[model samples]
Target: MQQNKNDLQTTNKTKDSERIPAIRMFNLEDESSAFEIGSIPILMPTDATSFWASNKTEDWEQKMHPAPRKQYVVTIKGKLKFTVSDGSTFILEPGIILLAEDTIGEGHSWEIIDGNEWIRLYIPLSADADDHFIAENIG
Candidate 1:
């Protein structure tokens, strides 16, 4: 049997890295549109529901739930400003990624900074049915 070099490299990197494994089953760039932006599911845990959030900002504002799962946001264009309940604000720029664990407390809101584009990937605490199965229907 023949093995590909890139595959071997990826395997080696996975084994060497101490961080969470990277799953690239979905692409955000394909979902962009001029109006009515939307999101898609990328990597879903076996016992949880995971999906992506993509939208365009044009002086639009909204409040968001803390969510029962973890969240990872990556800005593709413009800027995004998040104001937490504690009165601290966070700004996300292009090519930057932000991760919010499920353990974090609630009270968070988001807004577009000067009509920017925002894309977010959500990972649930439990696994999805396709990813894996929990014992005794715990999920």
Candidate 2:
């Protein structure tokens, strides 16, 4: 018996998954905080429900603050320098995804970088599925 090329290819096949960058926020009883990660919110459509876009000139200086809602941010253009409460900083460029959820106390600060224009998408979380993320370790 001879082995076909398809058989050989199938035997060597590999499974690949998509992992997006994210900045997770937590609303503690006393204060709010944020963290950065390279992976987040399983690649499913149930949790992420709504989305909006922000396209504007990147010339504003935002102080430490929390996100207005629990959502995901997907960068489409330009860059942003984010600094968390832990004194950590991250530079986000195009194709980076950030999950912003710290809607409680002290959040994070960010400033536009690299260019004068920035575009991104804001995806809100589903109320029911939001709890799932709250209890799970996504990092």
Candidate 3:
């Protein structure tokens, strides 16, 4: 049987906390974009402006571009492979959230890996707000 998205995410979370898997793409001091593999609280509350949803992506999405703003990309369908400036990559799917904060550099790009449409929610974070991305492997 196919495991539920929540079940799959639980297998990758901290033992003491239930967090959804997440990856943050951000700008380094040199203005190059990088990513951290991590997770965020399952139900954390934060400030956000009007949100939007989309199932279609433009050709530019496959090319490198900075995020328009700090926001959360909540994917409800489709699997995508995102590549950062250093050529490193990660996969995003259900149960995984992407916090895109590299709004000023060669941020990242992605392409659909699964045949399903890229249905998603974009929640723009409030200015100067904390995104609460936990870099799980940080020392």
Candidate 4:
């Protein structure tokens, strides 16, 4: 009986190890002029979840949905310029991270200054039972 229980625990650990890691990337469709262009993953957790290492770059301009949960933006690469709805701008560089509350309003904007390359990990405020956490929290 003890051996059977040990086997069951090992099996559960293997199953947990098989769980997917939530890391994603966005790519530009065309290599034309600097325009509002980037890719967003289709599968994003809603509640307080966490992302490992992710990267994004945009030559033009773009907006990020205010996080449904508080967010930590960690920059792993080039410069990223952020503009909030209140007409405030922040420039972030590599090895820098910022924390902000998920608030409602006009939202925030991003632009790549001097060619932007940023790696970030997003930790959501709730558990990700499903992707529905994002919908339930943001919407």
Clashes of each: 11, 0, 0, 7
lDDT of 4 by residue, 6-105 (tens): 8999997875454322211111233111112112233444455456666744533376544344454556676767665545566766544444443444
Q: TM-scores of all models?
A: 0.42, 0.69, 0.85, 0.46
For residues 1-139, could you state the per-residue lDDT of candidate 2 as single tens digits?
9999998776645211334445565656667575645454355554675688988533333787877887777888888888877777878887556777777677888888888777888788775564233323455
Which segments of candidate 2 are over 4 A away from where they belong?
Answer: 1-16, 41-43, 57-61, 130-139
| Local accuracy of candidate 1 as per-residue lDDT tens digits, 46-107 | 35455665564333235643433444455556666666554456565664444443233443
Query: Which residue pairs show collisions in model 3?
Result: none
Model 1 compared with the native: what TM-score? 0.42
Give stretches of model 3 more than 4 Å off.
1-17
lDDT of candidate model 3 versus the reference: 0.88
**The candidate that achieves the highest lDDT relative to the unseen native structure:** 3
| Model 3 agreement with the true structure over 1-139: per-residue lDDT tens digits | 9999998777756553677789999999988899998988867787886899999879898899999999999999999999999999999998899999999978888988998589999999998888988888777
